[model samples]
Target: MQFDLNRITRKNIQLLKPYSSARDEFSGEAKVFLDANENSLGSPLTKWYNRYPDPHHVQLRNKIAAIKGIAPEHIFLGNGSDECIDVLFRCFCEPGVSNTIICPPTYGMYQVSANINNVAIQEAPLLPDYQLNLAHIEQLVNADSRIIWLCSPNNPTGNLMNLEDIETVLNNFFGLVVVDEAYINFARQRSLISLLPDYPNLVVLQTLSKAWGLAGLRIGMAFAGMAIVEIMNKVKPPYNISEPAQELALKALDEVGQVNDMITLLVDMREALAAVFRQMPWVEVVYPSDANFLLVKMQQAHLVYEFLLDKGIVVRDRSRVELCDNCLRITIGTEQENTLLVDALAAWHEQ
Candidate 1:
């Protein structure tokens, strides 16, 4: 279908003249700097952090573009994907008027962000198989529906949403389609990032927190058409990502091979953990996962969750979530951690 970004983008945002920083206007290395009002005497910490970081994140975006096969202009790096998510609400959804649709038993942040922005959120719960309910989604969409959030290899569910269903939404929906791939590194399916060229309204988000082991760094990626990226940049803080985050992200990019090896190990561990869970009579279901975690349906899930907690073992109790009754979301931990969890469950079963 025809996707006109102007139709959904907030009128005030379209006319907004974003705040420009000193670094935004200048480039090239300099020996003595006296630009944006700094201490100039250098910071107390080793290595000068006296100056503000590059607001545009030039080097980080270029490195990411080279790896992802997208232009730097198409990338918008946020403090975390949360920033990008919030900015989208600010840029498109008009508070108390324009609304967004989200598939439930998915991520919670989408709903939280919508609430914070005062945008109405329409719920289209996933099918029993944990796939998109496209018909319901279509019925929910209206003139004021500005965005639709889909989480593949979905959180707490640990399964990828069917691609055909996603494509159908993109092909039919006039509003933007945001596909969050936070756990894509562990998934077998290819990222929808490659399809950005084919779908102008598509926005794919990924993060460094999971596979890269950089949760502390808090850098997230948003890949889209240059138009979307530019709009996001306009709405984002001038210096959202810190200097340390940019430096570490660049270093992590250099070690892609190491990251790949870690992913392979985690996938193996995920399957191994699933195998062990299947043997337990108490485990009613060990849902197949394209993620680094598993959603296990157990008998007396609340009791089991408490038992594990009492043993100093932690797992999310998602039994109250719709369609995930009696379920606990378990992360693929190290071998020792996994052994501890398994042993704890075994002991509980014995009792």
Candidate 2:
């Protein structure tokens, strides 16, 4: 399934001229930076933050490209994966003319972004078990469908959609297939990133927020053929990533071991907590998790949720979300935090 790689995306985007800053015109070692006006005296707060940052965030991209084994050109850094997701709809889907296919009981932002873009949405709800309904999805897509939104180990479900199912979509859909892997790092499944080169229509979304513990940094990375990336790069704010975020994320990358240790702790906590939740009589089921969170089904979900809130423990109430009735989404916190949650639930059940 080869796409024109060079073709297909919005026409307005191709003819658009991106604002060029002095920094945009140059890269590599420079003696004295006289680019986008910044205090040469340096900020009183931080010397490193004196200047305006690279619009393209090349350094951060290189670091990520090295880690992900892809060229920096194939990457587009956004304020968050949300931004990239939004931009994709903005760039490709023509308002009132094109639509996107989303599997609901999945991520809400996909629908939100599409709505904001004024792009129509075609729903293909996940099967009862929280897997893609490939047959239904195929039926929903039309000539106007320009994007197919997917979330692996999906947001509320905590389950991975079969890889083959996703591949089938990519192979069949002529539109851009945006696979949101925001939670991929926590999962053992191989990222859809590797499939980018194989499917030009593939766009894999990732972020530093989850695995790297840099949510405040708000850095989201998207990998696709350079063509799609270039289009997004043109549309995003010149300095989408603030200076401090770039610095912190880059430094965080340096301490890769620390990040791994944190993930290991969280993964261990996730498993331990899963076991505890399952043991509770009120807990009907604890969905398997590959991400930092768990989606749990309980007999008295609403009552338990209110009780936990009363105890100052906050977790998502996904009960009203389709296919997740009476389910509560819980993120694996520190060891002590998990203990508090477990104890709270146990006490609530006893009451």
Candidate 3:
């Protein structure tokens, strides 16, 4: 389909005059730094955090762009992927008017963000096998649907959405196709960030929380066309990302090799743990995962969840989630932690 960004972007967002901060007014080295009414004497703890963070995360975005082989102009950083999700809604979906499509048994934040923005949500629930129901998705698309949320190596289920199916939607959909790859670091399929240049409507969301071990930092990324990035930046809080988060994320980006090593170890552990679950009598099915987690369909799944909780262990009880009845989602933990889980399961079985 011929994509016209201006046509798809919300009218109010199109006319938006973004807030310009002191940093936005001036960039580069300065001596006195008498701008933005800072403490100037520095914070109670350290002088370093006295100044506000860069409203435009130049250094962090450039570093990430280098790593991801995308232009910094294409990147938009948020407090986390959730912020990115909210910003997308703010930028495109008009509240109580425009809508977005979501494939459920996917990320919860999509629906949550849509609700928070008062934007209508159209659900195209994933098929029984936990992949997109493309026909259902197509049927739901209309003039008002501004975004379609797809989570790869999807949460709860832990499997990647079929790449071709994603491309098909991208090919046909007139609005934004946001493929959230928060767990892409563990997945075998290549990120759709590479396809950004080809598809102006594609927005790829990723995070440092998972494989980078920076959930505490809360740095989330959105890669899209420069137009989309600009609009998102326009709507986002000027100093959304914190000083320490930007610094820590920059440092973490430098250690790609270390992160990859951890990913390799985690993927190995994930497979090993899945194997153990498969052999367990309580596990009815251990769904194949391209993510760092496994979704195990268990007999008495909620009871197993409670039993594990009693044992001081916790895993997501997705038994009530659509298409996930009697299932528990378990993240791949450290070797000792995995063993502890297995031992706990064995103990529960013995009971």
lDDT for each of the candidates? 0.93, 0.88, 0.93
TM-score, per-candidate, Cα-based: 0.98, 0.95, 0.98
Root mean square deviation (Cα) for candidate 2: 1.8
Of the two candidates 1 and 2, the one with more favorable TM-score, higher being better, is 1
lDDT of predicted model 3: 0.93
Instruction: Return the number of clashes found in candidate 2.
Output: 0
Q: What digit string (tens of lDDT, one per residue) describes model 3 on residues 212-330?
A: 99999999999999989999999999999999999989998999999999999999999999999999987899999999999999999999999999999999999999899999999
**Where is the poorest 10-residue window by lDDT in model 3?**
39-48
Candidates by lDDT, descending order: 1, 3, 2
Clash pairs detected, candidate 1? none
Worst 10 residues of 1 by lDDT: 24-33
For each of the candidates, the C-alpha root-mean-square deviation to the true structure, in angstroms, is 1.1, 1.8, 1.0
